[model samples]
Target: MQGKAGFWNLSNKLTLFRIGVIPVVALLLLSPGRAPNLVAAALFLVAAITDTLDGYLARRRGTVTPLGKLLDPMADKLLLVTALIFLIPLGRVPTWAVAVIVARELAITTLRGIAASRGVIIAASWLGKVKNLLQLAAANLLILHHPYFSIDPHRLGTYVLYLALFFTVWSGLDYLWRYSRL
Candidate 1:
């Protein structure tokens, strides 16, 4: 019933819900208020949960669809990209880092497209998953910028974000190397 499955399916619906949450998160984060940061982090956490749930349900229930596959990654990218971009103004993160992350993502995405057009399958690597987790954790920590329990979240998040950037570039290169083989 894969053909019968569409946007109405649980997996696809979760994907769409995640996508919808992106703008809300951005709006909440960007709003000038004391609570925006915490709110943004909470919304982002929910989105991340949806990302996990959707993928799990898709494979578990045999309801995978091309749309779900595309939307899921897109939602993740948008969430990460939005967070990084928004944080630039807040000075919690550097513009250069965001620029580098964005550039690598663009390059890898383009390479993936080219590889797909040439009938080459370049699946996500373990590094990519780690990069994502690092990015998500960094973003959340940065969002909660203030100190908590004698720990400077901003400083810690910066270090993690830098690591995410390292893996991002590494994974992009790996993907390009894969594409070149095709």
Candidate 2:
């Protein structure tokens, strides 16, 4: 396990793989064809799955390096933000919602940086975890953009995005409040 403390861990490689997929997913998303969109959705799903997998591996292996801590969140931001940015021109998502989510992410990251510099650790709250799950669900639903029987996935995705936005703000505030106490 002590050997796992270095940067050359399996979990770190998975995190890097997630980052590498971001551009492929983005470029594939921009292809002017339905097949490419479907492919993009599939790639995005794989990348999203890696998020959970990497974290699980890191914790279970006790190989959570500082680099993993940085790269993990960076990979998450790049994947989701890239999807949202590319989807904007396609009119598949609300720009204001995207803006709110991005803003919250930036704010929270800045807060984390400040906390880390001050030797204060503020772990993620339950609300933040739920927000991430909802964001992934929303991104998948929007990417699929297919109607399932009586349900319009696009509409449901929009609602999910709104809920994610609410939690993003709520969790950001919670983090800020928690940091203030420390």
Candidate 3:
């Protein structure tokens, strides 16, 4: 049963807020110019930050809900995947990289569902968390795309993305190796 906070709790609200801002960020990125990209990066960062904030708030306030659990991951995938796809058209990210990232996400998600069906719970791994952080950082940098004040966001983002891809493959294999018995 949900607590008194119910579905409208702050944490869930933040998750919903993250979902709500995704379209706005996408549209901002679609616009051409430094200002739009910068704004999109800022908004994307806010949404990503809320991902952590919402989880922390839910746990700390005892307001974790089934809906929250369901929406949080969905919101994250939508935001990150959308950003990556948008970045491709902007010439900010490579198609093959996005394909690998998407494939890993789908494979892991499918793996978890299969495990769940057999009465097993494959909990999130630390490497998975690190991958999320790396992806978020890369997406923000790649979205920003251009150099600013002696900082080249695209090159740096590409470097971070390589690390993210490494982690993504490692974590996916780790999950499969550990949970294949299920």
Ordered by lDDT, highest first, the candidates read 3, 2, 1
Q: List model 2 lDDT by residue over 70-159, tens digit each.
A: 899999998999899888888889898889889989988988888888897768789999999999888877876766678887899899
How many angstroms is residue 178 displaced in model 2 relative to the true structure, after the best TM-score fit? 2.2
Instruction: Give stretches of model 3 more than 4 Å off.
Output: none
Error of 3 at 115 (Å): 1.6
lDDT of 3 by residue, 1-182 (tens): 46579999999999999999899989998999999999999999999999999988998888999999989999999999999999998888999999999999999999988998999888889999999999999999999987999999999999999999999999999998998887
- lDDT (10s digit) by residue, model 1, range 1-182: 36356657998888888788888877877787548877888888888888778888888888888877788888889988998898898898999999988998898888888888988777889988888888898998898887778998889999999899899889878877766766
Top candidate (lDDT): 3
Winner by TM-score between candidate 3 and candidate 2: 3
TM-score: which candidate is best? Answer: 3
Clashing pairs in 2: none
Candidates' C-alpha lDDT: 0.84, 0.85, 0.93
Point out the higher-scoring one by lDDT: 1 or 2: 2
Ten-residue region with minimum lDDT total, candidate 2:
1-10
In model 3, the Cα lDDT at residue 76 comes to 95
Off by over 4 Å in 2: 148-151
